[model samples]
Target: MDQSFSGSIRWAGDNSKCLDVQGGSPLVGAHVGLWACRADHPNQQFAWTEGDGRIRWLTYPSLCLTAAAPGLPIQLDLCDSPTAPFDAAAHGTKAICTSEGVCMTVQDTEAALMLMMLGLGSCFLMMTPLSAFWRVTAAADAHDARLGRRLGWEQPGLMLMMLVFLAMVLMDINFCPHLGREQLQLMLMMLGVLVIVMLLMMPLMMLMMFVFHGALGVNGCG
Candidate 1:
């Protein structure tokens, strides 16, 4: 790595926070995140190595700030590791910094594509389970007054609104270079996981609702 300027990389959008290594850990995959700027935190120190734009951790010069892959969190990795994804020669994790050294960002077409796939694809997948859940509920033959009533667009509409809000927030990366690709990727992955968990719980939730409503109907009839 070509050594250049050394300093605490602060978020340009919010100067109060600086880039930090999670737990000050020396582990290869230790996460990188933003933290309150501290003048003396070794984990907050970084050097913008010029040529390849590698952000080298000054405390451990051999470890470079690396974006392991698209849709994954940023982490520390050996500067010259021979591993397929960690190979420094590929320069896949190279970052571009502002002239004043206030911010940094990794620009990669692949990473952007992965973020889109994870966010939009997962939301579309959720529609199937959501539709099925509503269908099952609508078809239930219980003597409850609400049986056979089809659900309106409210549920899915709310989900889509939530997704839109998330995307709006993540889109700040374009305006604020310091927002970082990993943060966006991590959030998208989280959205995907949340959708999956909701899908898995749909059946159980529907079953419980039926049991509770049926018990109410029986008691009313008695």
Candidate 2:
């Protein structure tokens, strides 16, 4: 209600998004506008909590209404055009939207958790083998044959990792929901274990490579 609480109307070029009403003022029937310039314009003026609480502009009736609660995205009547009446038959809820169409709904807490898990899982699958491949290539380049061979053993492993990465990415995008928080936590724990194992093994691998090369004068590509 305070005029100090100002925000921009992104769609409107004018600064008509300010909340000019004073605190404790009843907002039930107040007409909201894009800015002072358009304050009196009916297209910009909106009836709060009345007439469906929608803007009276050329835009859709349900254009930018916030959901009743947090984490709940706006529900839109997809069939309602900017110049037409809203049709309940085409209404849907979604987490994201674009000029083309609305993205699928994320649903509830479980869905959100699943999305996060899938993202992290894909990241892990992509990163692990890539890291190993780099270490192997580095060893080979350094003329450490034993190290190169040891690292080369990761070639097939890297391929499998890449396959998993691709599959996870595709699954995450296609599946409406993924693992819940508990499953996500488990996945994170598994990732942590993998990272710890890598940390413990990398040095040992390097040490072994160094010892083998020093004792045998072996070189990669030989």
Candidate 3:
């Protein structure tokens, strides 16, 4: 390895928690992910030795983080993973460690499809706000009693759009491995933006309602 590592490796399924050395033991197949990190505990720490291919638990010097076979539960045991050499100058690190030969296979067409979906989603999101704008502008120019009622349904529609967009994003990144803190944070931020938009939708609609009332002298809720 060309990178110097000094952080916790998280589990693949759950981003909130990281890997833990089970029972603080040096025995083979001792099990892993016993619990969450506790104030930078030694057992949860991992480091690359000069010649070892596997991540060694700092609490138990003799044991290595290992999974002998694919689909097998990972555990600490005698070092069996491919050797990773230490580098004094390299600054990068991979936060999710796995046994040798483990990797996600994303086909060429899958990559292209993801790009296309991204473009479509972007276009849809852009056009959606414009649709909301168009509704208010059109009603102001030519009054319609049913327009406000139709606008009420837009909240559910926007929510559905958000859910669909998020699902597409998740499906596009599905089967990917070794996602770390930054990626999870990014996904959460994306969801946060959707949430903010969701919250703002009501106020935006209310503003539009006021605009409708002012323009056409309409009264009461639609």
Candidate 4:
């Protein structure tokens, strides 16, 4: 091994992390994430071809850095062979060139504003159906109370659950925005699971509404 850092492409800072293939896995889909610089790590070695503008993995000469799409994870893929069609997107776009050989670009402020707007829109979309369902339940319970029947707890229970859900959503939006990449990924995973669960429960919610209304109608409480 050469005793110099000529082959290693690392960040400009003295202690900055290097671009590393996650876990040093030799698989085609191995993720490219940042890791602490290790002089001896082959995963941190990459070759940038100025002529073709392709960043190739030195550990696997046949593999090159490939991006499937915008906002997706980068991974190693088979290098574009001569027979393959020329993919103009494989090259980098215009960016703020730095003295450290790092390309910088300012994030679009409109994107952030649109994301915030989408989040608020989703909250309202979710709340609209829930609030309407709870209103129906409240009306049923009110009728039952007038008829000398015991009041059901479903209305209050749903309200409490909704409050807790909103609180969690608010925390996610207002809490620390400087979380580490891994922490942010974990949080997003958990949120995704929560969303899946809510989606799956939609049918069950409909069933509950049908049963509650049916029972109330039979008791002349609707």
Q: How badly does each model clash, as a count of residue pairs? A: 0, 2, 3, 0
| Tens-digit lDDT string for candidate 3 (1-222) | 322343454322222334566666667767665344344566566655554444566666567665444344556676544432211111121112232323211112322111001112222221322111211111122222122212222333555655665674465345344445665576566556545644555445334434433422221111
Please give the ranking of all candidate structures by TM-score, highest first, separated by commas.
Answer: 1, 3, 4, 2
For 45-143, candidate 1 gives per-residue lDDT tens digits of 776565655667889988886653334556788867532121122111111222222112322322221110111222222232221111110112212
C-alpha positional error of residue 82 in candidate 2 after TM-score superposition, expressed in Å: 69
Q: What is the lDDT, from 0 to 100, of the residue 11 in candidate 2? A: 17
Off by over 4 Å in 3: 1-3, 80-100, 103-222
lDDT of 4 by residue, 108-159 (tens): 2322111001112222222322211101112112222121111123323334
The predictions' CA RMSDs to the true structure, in order, are 22.6, 22.7, 22.3, 24.3
Q: Best candidate per lDDT, number?
A: 1
Candidate 3 clashes between residue pairs 3 or more apart in a chain or in different chains: 53-82, 53-83, 53-84
For candidate 2, lDDT tens digit of each residue in 1-222?
111111111111111222122121222322221123233323332222232223222233333322222233333222233421211111111011221222112223322211101112222222322111211111112232122212222323334643553454345434524445654454445445544443344454334434432422222211
Q: Any idea what lDDT model 2 has? A: 0.27
The lDDT for every candidate, in the order shown, is 0.45, 0.27, 0.40, 0.40
Error in Å for residue 207 of model 2: 27
